[model samples]
Target: MASWKFPGFLIFFTLFSCSFSYTFTITNNCAYTIWPGTLAGSASPRLSTTGFRLDSGQSVKLTTVPGWSGRIWGRTGCKFDTMGIGNCETGDCGGKLECDGNGAAAPTSLFEITLGAGNGQDFYDVSMVDGYNLPILALPKGVYGGACNATGCMTDINLGCPTELQVLGGNGYQVGGVVGCRSACEAFKLDKYCCSGEFANPNTCQPSYYSTIFKKACPRAYSYAFDDGTSTFTCKASEYAIVFCPNSNGNQKPNPAPASPPPPMRRPHPKGHVVPSSSNIVLLPFPVPMLLLVVSLSFSFIVERPWPVI
Candidate 1:
């Protein structure tokens, strides 16, 4: 007699099949300048592809990673290093409020604006990955009111950000007081940042276009801004209350990702079994060949059995 077992031959043997597919969209929340030069990350820009870059009024449809995350955008001018980042420079300051960070050229000042949230009660700094902190916003044709008046206060003034004060602090290593406003503004809120209604009202002011925000930072001290060690702003903060302009206002609740369910539990097995499936099975190419002899003999005996045979 011979014995054999074929996957628990339940009341009967049956066939089955199944298939599935998954699709997704992605967005990168953090990344470096699209390109870097002799300054820092000049070796490779691969890790820099994480975020998206847009000019004054440009937009893009993100499709890499999905879900909302904090993001930064800018339109760098001359620092347009073909393979490097152009730091603060005079030639192109991305319209003044931003930095051009070019190696050879001088730093140039461009546009500046401030945006706030709430009644502009209390303002906070926008923290950056490297401890570099700031608030952000986008301004159009930025403006800068010159030297603080005799009272160390510049009032109701705007002169499209000054190229004179435009300084790139990132590469220099160290600078003091509130760093001059970097060409870019930290993300911020409209209510948090504000200019005196007395300063020019948005509606009344002559703007190339409207900036999401436009207000001065530390409007008390001589109002002039100074650069910090990290290419950040402290205002002539030490000199006087620095009143730098800004654009970003990170005032809203940053969006969050929905929680994902834990993956299905799988049991441990001595040896993983190959699940049978109707779709994957080739109709005749099974272990049937090995069972051929046994099946034939069983059939012969059943056919010749006395009870039903003549």
Candidate 2:
């Protein structure tokens, strides 16, 4: 009888382990509300909601089954009608309140992830390959594995945004100012900036001047197209917290660089700022409340975990 029971127990455990869901908590730490957008991968399941509002200090959690992979971005200064149709300053998905499966427009920071990815590990990264709107952080909770946690951009890049890459707008407020920053690819569509054409390969596409500036501001983030070594991280957490404007002041005010140099300006653009002689360049400006969506993870074991939730 004991031998028969052991077989049944083993079968149950295997089934449960094979079908576990991971919870993701998206928190808004900025001074204003944000609309978080989600784009499911081609093979991944559709999310419960593709986009939704996340007010300041609020959080929301969503769950995904194993093998789920995709990206998440934030949209600020969004305005929607009663029908839930509208647009945003940055990370707008076809100007729709609900993004569905479409990717956000360029010049928006990105958080990409692949669960149960290669070598039985989950790969995640905070990328500025598109550009930057808000400071973001992706942290693992109670994860037991290698160094796979606490990676994101904490510095407000818009404060020091190059004049050419500045996105000036009301930024969901009454006053107009610099709301976000644009990537080198968006600012100048050259092959080197976009890492396209002959420069697609990692060897040929070395970091350029603009990428170097971004790297100096946020070392943990992907500053350029081929920033794989320090940018990508691996982990095995049952849950993750994706925080927008993480660890910001309580006021949640949007920090827009002054249009004109302030009389008492304290910070200035870095040395060798790129200035486009052509004035037609377009600068584009660029989510969620969940307390906690907990998932039971019986696989937790002792491992050399290095970082805490950031």
Candidate 3:
């Protein structure tokens, strides 16, 4: 027997006085949030807990939270590791692909952080186990950097829109869902970061891949930092706040240099005259609830053992 947890509620309903055949569809006479998951119309092809098929006019009252821009015409795997960036011919890639976020424009609203059934509407936190799907091709610009995971953006892929296309020229780590992204000239402090969480989730991965990705991405704390796909640039010793920029690459030789750092912790204010303007700030606005999701080997061992000859 196999059991899994994804707040997907499958409902098959039809509208209009007609009989139709739909490969996939969702229709209901009521308004119910689909797992209350984050639905951003961006470029990262995230794991969707609630994916359904529709036949033409059928509807799911997702107006309160909004579903994908258009429709769930077909299913595809994660964008990364799909051989080619925009190629997702398979149904589910099974975490083999890395995730790069949409580059053209960011999601226009607070698409992250819907609380659980018990939690209030003001509930949200960075996802340690799941993310949303973005069809980059659907964006007006046709490209993106990627959403930043707790670790970093994985890589570039097609926008999870109605078309298939490729757009690059980012640090390959802009993939992010609930956290602020680190594309362009953005900067972040690590101390105030809530990126570090479980290094692995047994519920999502096979025993082999779980151990491999976890071992590789573990040891290092998870964070959505300003990175260049080759290195994570956040200051591990200090709190961080991100400021995104348009031209982050060093090649754009423009404008006079900004004021240089005088020295470490050297403020212009007089001694003992602390100012409110330079106070501490939280990098991410939303609060996270869960701890590191990485399961220990002992926990892993027990899960695999299973019921004894039940």
TM-score of each: 0.20, 0.79, 0.18
Candidate 2 local lDDT, 1-310, one digit each (tens): 9999999999999878755667777887777888999887666655677788888777777777656777888988889988879988888998788898878776677888767632356767788787887778787775866544467787777777878887886754423366678877777778877778888666778888878767777776777766767767778888778888764653744453322110000111112111111111111222322222112112232233221121
**Alpha-carbon lDDT, every model:** 0.19, 0.67, 0.19
Indicate which candidate wins on TM-score. Answer: 2
Better of 1 and 3 by lDDT: 1
Better of 1 and 3 by TM-score: 1
lDDT of 3 by residue, 1-310 (tens): 1232222221222222112211111221111111111222232123232233222122322221111111121222224433633323222222222222221122111112111111111111111111212211100011123222222111111221111111222323222211111211112221212122331222221222221232233212111221112222111111111111111221221122211110001001111111111111111221211122111111211111111111
Candidate 2 to truth, TM: 0.79
Sort all candidates by lDDT, best to worst: 2, 1, 3
Candidate 1 structure quality by residue, lDDT tens digits, 126-153: 2111111121221111112221111111
Candidate number achieving the greatest lDDT relative to the actual structure: 2
lDDT of 2 at 254: 40
Give the Å error, residue 256, model 1: 36
